[model samples]
Target: METVRVNLGSRSYDIALTHGATANLGAFVRAALPKTSSVLVVGDSNSWPHAESIQATLTRAGLRAGSAVVPAGEASKCLERLAGLYDALYELAADRSTAVVAVGGGVIGDLAGFAAATYNRGLPLVMVPTTLLSMVDSSVGGKTGINHPKGKNLIGSFHQPAGVWIDLAFLNTLPAREFISGLAEVVKYGVILDAAFFAYLESNSHAVRTRDPGALLRVVTRSCRLKADVVEQDEYERTGLRAVLNYGHTFAHAFETCGGYGTLLHGEAVSIGMECAAQLARKLGLIGDEFVSRQTKLLDALGLPTAPPTRWPADDLIAVMRRDKKAVGGQMRFILPTRLGEVKLFDDVPEPLVRTVLESAVSR
Candidate 1:
């Protein structure tokens, strides 16, 4: 097992990664939480079996445990589902001493983590990410929240998890498209932070596509370490340092919002968002066509979309971008790559330029 630490001083925690790590979920929970605390295993419908197994393990370990299953989809990450979770905790008589075990994808982690953050002031959160996107990104960060009607992640908090347990076994059951969707974030890490990691991915793309265990370990561990380093520096995103992690998210969130949340998966939108950002960077003379070409080739090889879907209008997409969380005073802000392994946040990006890019991205 490999361990990566998010050093938030008082809120510090470790992300443990290994094959079949879920089998040791009880031990991980025991170490971080008190025996007196009860555990609420919040699972998504697709991952309820794993949740049940975890609940059983926790019960056998002498901790009071209960399980709640949320439907599997982006829609579940909303205020209504959150209220349902609150009701579940209330009926279980859970209190501050209760810990929420999020046993599914990013949606589950965000929803359950938000519940843990708000319930009775706060409760401990244990993230057991069942999806690649959750494992590499959402699960490790203290960022948690349900989606709002206006925007993606507009109603979230910076509540860090008590422990993050990543089991490679979960990937075995993930749909091909879902698995491919996650590579967008993996590619984001390489684009904004690690050129060598990007090259490694390019060379080992086949291994990664096949879900080879060794490649997955390296990918997940390195991705977590890179993100952890950034989170350690900017836990609450107060400083501009953590904004680099949103390399393609500004555009990605816009795509998601314009698609009405359910039309496109988060990572699918991210894949196209990264391409658009790269194109915009090229237009701004920050990088060359070769840079865009290389990134595109890699994304194509990985079976990820590198162009915007035709369903959403370009103008509407730009409007959504203007409302992104990174926007200030209604001005658009973007994390654009200057080159592979580096990016910088640009504010007050001209609306005309953004519109032109969006126009070309969707039409292509």
Candidate 2:
């Protein structure tokens, strides 16, 4: 097992990554949670079957578990769905002391975290992340929310979890596309901070995709450690260190928004967005053609999309980017890669250059 700590002072927590850790979840929660008598297990419909095992584990350990099942997909992460979950929680007779366990992907984590944050003011939120993207990113940082029609994760709050339980066995059931999407986030960890890790991915992409236990464990542990290190230093994203995690998200949000929700998965948008960012970096002379080609090639090899849909107009892409949370005073803030693993924030990025990059990216 690999453990990473997010030191947020009062809200600090630990993220544990292991191949077959689910079996020990009850014991871990009992040791970590102040009161484990009751927990609301929130998961997507697709995750309910596996969640049954988790429910049993919790029950056998003296924890009474109530479950709320939401439809699986991005569309469910909305106010309406949240409202439904709120009703379910009410029917379940949950209280402030009830611990909420989110046992699916990013969508479940975001919704359940938000519910726990708002339920009777607040509850102890426990995360049992079953997806790669959730394990490395969404499950660690306190950032939780559902998407609005206007933008992704627009309506949310920063509610950190009490603990995060990651079990690699769930990856065995993840579809190929979902698995590759998770790798996009894994790559993001490298692109933003660890160049050596990026090189490792470049060399071992195939093995990682094939679900080699050793390779997946190494990648997940490293990614979680890096993210935890940054979040501990800047828990509320007060410092810009945490913002670097959005290296490719500016373009990614635009891609997903324009493409329509469900048309492109978050990871898929990110994969293409990273390519767009790389192109922008090269156009700005921040990096060279060789670097862009290298990143794009590795992304392609992973079976992830490396280009935005050509159907979107450059103007639309630019328009959506302007609405991103990172935008300032009507100017867009971009997370650009200055080198292979070093990303920087650039508020001075000109519109023309941005437009040019978007045109080239979507056209490709």
Top candidate (lDDT): 1
On the 0 to 100 scale, the lDDT of residue 237 in model 1 is: 88
Judged by whole-model lDDT over C-alpha atoms, candidate 1 comes out at 0.89
- Model 2, position 292, has a per-residue lDDT of 87
Pairs that clash in candidate 2: none
Worst 10 residues of 1 by lDDT: 306-315
- In Å, residue 19's CA in model 1 sits off its true spot by 0.8
Q: After superposition, how far is residue 256 of candidate 1 from its true place, in Å?
A: 0.7
Candidate 2's TM-score: 0.97
- Report the Cα lDDT for residue 89, model 1: 92
How would you encode candidate 1's per-residue C-alpha lDDT over 222-260 as one tens digit per residue? 999999999999988889999999988888898888778
> What CA RMSD would you report for each candidate?
1.1, 1.2
Give me the runs in candidate 1 sitting further than 4 Å from their true place: none
Off by over 4 Å in 2: none
In model 2, what is the error at residue 331, expressed in angstroms?
1.2
